[model samples]
Target: MCNNQLTITNPRYLKYARITGNPVHVYSGRDDYRLRVPCGHCDDCLKRRQQQWFSRAHHLMKRMALRPDQCLFCTFTLKPSVYEQAKEKPYIPIRQFLDRLRKHPRFREKDPITKRYRYRKVKFPYLFVVEFADGKTAAKRGRVSTHRMHYHAILFGCPLYWWQVRDLWQGDVVDEAKGWYTGMGKAEVDPLESESGVRYVLKYMTKDCAAHQYISDVDARKNGKLIVSHGFGRLSKEDIKIMRKNMLRGASSWFCHFINNYRYSIPRYWKTACFSPNEIRCRNDSLIPGILRDFVKKRYPFPDFTFQQQQQIYNCLLWP
Candidate 1:
């Protein structure tokens, strides 16, 4: 079972907890008080990780100012023979291939000062989730059928056309047996048409099967990386502070409750509410009323009300 609560001992984090309602703890720490490392199979931990990833992706999209047209959803697969060679550590070769592809001359321009090739203006922030599929045909043949590894990625600021990307991905491998050129198994590239498309790409990180497969790999399991990313750069202390503020502003009441109760010692208020018969509501119920009314009034300016009537309406809505 996953330990849902953690004890706060660090002075820095304790201070943070006092100021903000958040309980901060070191993830995967080996200390006696800290919870055991996540197994990646526990439902509670999995859900928490999914939410963390969603928030991270949301933050990255906003920070980069990425538009739908600037993003591409891409899938990359490896040939059966290639996978067979590195079955134990498939991600190693795939990571190497991605590094090479990113540095390909097609996406580079010569610097006027140094006359050296440099990547184009596009920063090319990208996220990749590795997934596996079973080969039914190979299983039927009585051969040891291993899981085939592939990647689904959300790429930003990639200027290449789908076909062009496909061609570049195929590379210049010549298949002697077939008497023609071949590349990797297959590649698919499609433009993101809307924000939903980005979410669709991020959804792969939450799939139970995908998580299981990634955890099955010895290297990836040891590292505990559910997804691979590049070019976004590191987050500084200031950036983290800003992100936390943004998260609090946009978070739902349930999320706030979770954050506030994340410690081993549950607060008295939540404990009382938990035992109460009546359904518990958010502490500050009035927080959303004004925003909701303004949105409703702006979208559907229904039967206009006078000052006195508006006051009555507000009173009725705010009634406990």
Candidate 2:
């Protein structure tokens, strides 16, 4: 006889996968239109974390009052060719393009108004942010497959023409015959709209959240990388990296805090039930029996909630 009580204390854990009739405790949470099993490493959890960073970044842009009318939104893509198609990690060229953009005189120039005199040049120190999204398109018959490494970038500074931006990326190359020079591929530029439009631009980057895809795709890890920024209150490369690390650490701490303050009580029907650690592993399907599932469903309408809500409910002695 299993004498272990199954109790749920953490709201972060949405559901338990049922592997046996060992009487496991499970919680149901709504993610989008369907119920999701939320583990710390699940795709939904990762997407939520990434969205937090995106929201923070958006807030920072608003605080700075970055005018989108003066900004440029550009998409940089790698060209399709025999040599380009042969590469495994296609995003390597995208990284090189970003490095070149960082070192480019046009990008590094910070003189706000250097063109005042005849001997001066126009200076535009601005913020440059880029997000990576999968461009992996399926190849039809007689077509070659490529990773389609690309980036969507927002340049919060002087306006630039489409051809000018393309040429600048092209100028990064020294050898035209090696095909490395042609990797600049296609570059598209357009004048940015309002703040809401900026969000729309970033929307594509967060579309499909596939944990396995992220691990295998070369472009996935570059989603939040800051390409270049030269102006007042600019973050250096190291600072950006540190800030990202801190953000992830902060998320982990939130879960830990919740876990520390969590207290679980056994229900009346399962007064003697307790779960062993070795038997608490994830499995498919529901661990809750039909009767208990109906009982819990009638009591708690939703199982998913934030840590703060969990703390509030605990303080109020609310459990279902």
Candidate 3:
């Protein structure tokens, strides 16, 4: 587990609390002040990111009205020599390859009637993850152990044949005897048969690679240029808002606060007001102040508070 919990001690939160007449009670134990910051390198942070990506991709698939048959799972790789040349900065070649592939004549063809080159009418929304695999496992299968970097992608509204993609990726180097292009590298495409395929491709977003063999895969993601798309653009602001709203509904305050303000230190107000380790000793409803009760009721109306839970409600509103 990542022991990178950041402590929240911002004075602004204290000022806000004082201004609101809810002066935060400073806890004596230092452990109570800890905040879980979502550092991207940690497993927990990566898992959350994976879930977020899955949600966004699933929502995008539905928004595009695409069926499983309309989607294709594709893989693209570079030649061993090419990988060796750019091993330290793998994202450079990956970006260059994707850019060239997108601008290839097959993907963007000139209209016969207008003689104008235009992208295809169908929407092409894609999500891809660049993966680096040190092929030590290949030894069991009688294969050489080598470093392999490749892309796993889920492309929507694809209309081309597998060989067409190969030809495009390999720069049309045709092997006349083999009836297919044997060019620089490999390209494999298969129909996405079910919803599970979406999860399958997105799974690579959190896939871990051995740190000893090469650089961390997370470093490649930090470059933020591996994405390739044609007709469909990125998710709109409204779409993201809707997805976040849906995800945060009925969620805990700690989780909601962390996600809403990721990579930042948690506010002192959240630590003091939203969560506590001490058990409530007072349970009398009449003991709660009318103003505090109304505020808590207005903010959280879903849960039916029982006699035993009244103390918890009061603690959340006016932390002791």
Please give, for residues 11-77, the per-residue lDDT of candidate 3 as tens digits: 5556756888864555324433434444555566555556555555555677778888778778877
Every model's TM-score: 0.53, 0.41, 0.55
Each prediction's RMSD to truth: 13.3, 15.9, 11.4
As a TM-score, model 3 comes out at 0.55
Candidate 1: residue 72 lDDT (0-100) = 78
Instruction: Show the colliding residue pairs in model 3.
Output: none
lDDT of each: 0.56, 0.45, 0.57
lDDT of 3 at 39: 54
Best by TM-score: 3
Model 1, which residues run further than 4 Å from truth?
Answer: 1-38, 111-122, 134-146, 172-182, 206-225, 230-320
Task: Give me the runs in candidate 2 sitting further than 4 Å from their true place.
Answer: 1-43, 80-145, 158-162, 171-183, 204-208, 211-320
Candidates ranked by TM-score: 3, 1, 2
lDDT of 2 by residue, 147-192 (tens): 4445566666643555566766655565667646544665677777
- lDDT for model 3: 0.57
Please provide, for model 1 over 1-320, each residue's C-alpha lDDT reduced to its tens digit, 9 standing for 90 to 100: 35543444555455666788765553225343342344555566655555555455554666678777777777877776676554566467556656666676787898999999788654456777665544555678888655556777777666666666666656665875662436666678888787676666655554553335533555344222344565243455566455345434642532232322341222233334333322223433535676556654664455675656665666654541
As for lDDT, the candidate ahead, 1 or 2, is: 1
lDDT of 1: 0.56
Separate clash counts for every candidate: 0, 4, 0
